[model samples]
Target: VISSFKIADIGTVDLDTIGTVEAGGMTVEVIDPVADYAELMESLFDFDALRALFKSGFRMRFDAMHAVTGPYAKEILENRLGAPNGTARNFIPLPDFGGHHPDPNLVHAKHLYDEMMGPDAPDFGAASDGDGDRNLIIGKGIFVTPSDSVAMLAANAHLAPGYKAGLKGIARSMPTSGAADRVAEKLGIGIYETPTGWKFFGNLLDADMATICGEESAGTGSNHVREKDGLWAVLLWLNILAARGESAKQIVTEHWAAYGRNYYSRHDYEEVETD
Candidate 1:
């Protein structure tokens, strides 16, 4: 929800539009929708597990791209999940995202990528898009491609309590790489493939045909909610890492070795009108 309009261009918006925000020692109650959402997140996610995961030497970073999710990420990952004060970056809620695109990709998030490539990088790194639905995950020297990310998450989802019962099935967009299909086959569960758009998977999720759905567009989610959730994916990765006690690089390398890697890229082409 990072707005494209700058605060200087337009007058400041009333707090009512931002839902609820916590400032200083005093709590400011606005329209209260965000408060409800915060409570919902507490109920949905396992905070105790996250709390333990953040303890000790498990350092990490969540780049907010100077977007609206900045505040939410800081609150959840730092205050609630015990990720430490500096776990989040570019955390101020800016309307224009400080002129950044907020896509959570290597091109837009090149600075974060540079940090990950540098010697002083943390154990893990992640970025969430402006709307807070898409996520990009990286570990030390490795940058996990979106296709591989979904597959890896699907394979290790059971490590988390919410998905410990295991998924009934999984869904992926048509153009996505087949990495997840390998996991589905091995697990002996159904694999549903649909055309582009999250709406395409809605029916399956509602009917319980698919427990999780993802896309090559950096979207991922489960029946816990209908939409792709950036923080949800981040927390899932953290849980898996905590359970395995392995670095993200190690896990990804092992996964590719086991299942083989699927490499693909998106391209844009400009064309002339056809006769």
Candidate 2:
């Protein structure tokens, strides 16, 4: 297979293992085989589409981990958010310092939590699990449950850069807290509750009828991707920050002070047998 060959063994490989080749400085390189069709389709997204979307005020939310993909997502968000030179500090990338785990939570992501609570903290602070799918939302000294986060996004949708086009609908996973339903009710918009997996929301998002989808496990995203994204939620929070001209903490504090504090929490049990 193509993966079995070393960089130097490209030219010596037989036809069956060959994919593609390039020659430079007396060296031949073989390309890895295509992993999946969907990846190829995703690569077809053009830079101009991003530029146009950003110009029209399209934004992204995402979670940042220590992995390379996290930085890649940040770069994309900066470019779309009109940051100069494609650099922004709202969701700055922290190095894998002191063997830290990049998960986003009060228990596991203490560094980010501390910063968010401190003076001069970022307008928004967000983190992702190892794979950049899970998210934790923090605003000035408090953590937002994913249910509240997604609902807040819906309630504040019109304040986002591009959401003036208006949200088509809202959706949440079955286990998610029911906050978004209130937002939907207030806005006179549709709300859908599906199974735990994000894939079930595909039909709604694909229909251009839903602008946000979230799960109770700290996962959130918009119509941007079919999968739940931590960083995407972060960017959405920043979009609100930019629009409101408020710190993350201030915004959430105002929210709770007005909403009377839902006081939501979760408990998990391990190895429970269904039988």
| Model 2 stretches with alpha carbons more than 4 Å out | 1-63, 73-102, 119-122, 257-261, 268-275
The lDDT of model 1 is 0.83
Model 1 root-mean-square deviation: 7.4
lDDT of 1 at 150: 86
What lDDT score is found at residue 172 in candidate 2? 93
User: Candidate 1's residue-wise lDDT over 1-275, tens digit each?
Assistant: 96686333333446746455455444555665445555656665567776887886678999988876687778788888889898999988688888878889888888888999899999899999988889999999999887888889989988777788888899999999999999898888999999999998888999898888889889988888878888778878887888888999999999999988898786634356766
lDDT tens readout by residue for model 2, 65-153: 45434554545545433433423222444565226565566676776677767776644556677666777877666778887898888
Ten-residue region with minimum lDDT total, candidate 2: 33-42
Q: Give each model a TM-score.
A: 0.83, 0.65
Task: Flag clash pairs in model 2.
Answer: 61-231, 61-232, 61-233, 61-235, 62-230, 62-231, 62-232, 63-230, 63-231, 140-249
| Leading candidate by TM-score | 1
Please give the range of 10 consecutive residues that has the lowest summed lDDT in model 1.
5-14
